[model samples]
Target: MGSSSSPSGGGGGGNGSEKEGNSSRPRFFNKKEKSICWAKAETVPGRHPERWRKDAADNVVCKRLFNCLGCLCFEYDHIIPYSKGGESVAENCQILQSRVNRFKANKDEVDTTQLKGYSCDIKFTDKELDIIEMAVYGDVIRPGNQCRCRTVAEMLGKYKSKDSTAACKLPQSSESL
Candidate 1:
């Protein structure tokens, strides 16, 4: 599914301004590109949860608190640093926890060698991936942006009760998994 050209059909350079000979800044991922990236990232086994939950108890003390059902939130991350010339494509984006994303910053690429160790039996449909991405990245207060979790919960249907929580719980040690 890799394309030589960007989804925008532009093939200049990382900044898309190579042809013009004016390379100032890297090009930002458009909405559609971001969506595609998020969806593709979600399909990876052992990927981080698309959303995170901070219960009311946890929210009372957390530094950055969100007020959704169970304080659900999501963050979009670049797998490779844009500053390092990583294109904003599906293969180079990931959904990460807010705290993890903050700690990661524009440092280095995430190591995926360990992902093979995690056994993930869950399979998400494209629509489900889209909803999860929107819930985590979309502005929650706006009319259309509100209640993304509810939409996802509905899509999950029977599995709603079982998978409602999307917390990012870190393993304590290599043996924890």
Candidate 2:
């Protein structure tokens, strides 16, 4: 039998501030914890198994979308809320869509309805999804003929402009080539 003291367990720290060298629970999950959390959830097909995971709301979240402020993005969340005495560990971690996470804030909730209410309703085709992956991450998970959609830019040549703000420069149309 061991003894433990909870800051919230009918007691208060003097002045709520004290010199406790490295005693505070970690505010974030370590890489190993994150991996464990991801593995515990259902996997998705895109990219790699570890790159995608189902959020608490059951929405597919991509690690590539880390810190993004919308759907399909995710942030590591404290399942029990650190402020509410949750420890930072794999057992206490989850990935939630950015919007759902922000809305959830510090509340320890498992309500699928509340979480889903904040998710986006947009549906995307696989090629559009690949385009987004390219735009945001500069790499595509699906390559070659596997993805049937073609970019108008495809019939057109690849961009030659160096400046991002400059208009996309494609070589003269095939008729001129």
Best by TM-score: 2
What lDDT score goes with residue 82 in model 1? Answer: 60
Q: Give the TM-score of candidate 1.
A: 0.35
Candidate 2, residues 33-152, lDDT tens digits: the string is 767877887776554454556787778777777666667877777778766777667788777777777777778755889888887776555555555655665444442322222355
Taking the tens digit of each residue's C-alpha lDDT, what string does model 1 give over 1-177?
111123442321133234312665434454565456444542333222333222111211111222111212234445666656666655676544343444455667444433222212244543343444444554222222232344445546744444444432223457433
Q: In candidate 2, which residue pairs clash?
A: none
- Model 1 score (lDDT): 0.38
- Overlapping backbone residue pairs in candidate 2 total 0
Q: Which runs of model 2 end up more than 4 angstroms from their true locations?
A: 1-22, 45-47, 142-177
Off by over 4 Å in 1: 1-26, 43-71, 112-177
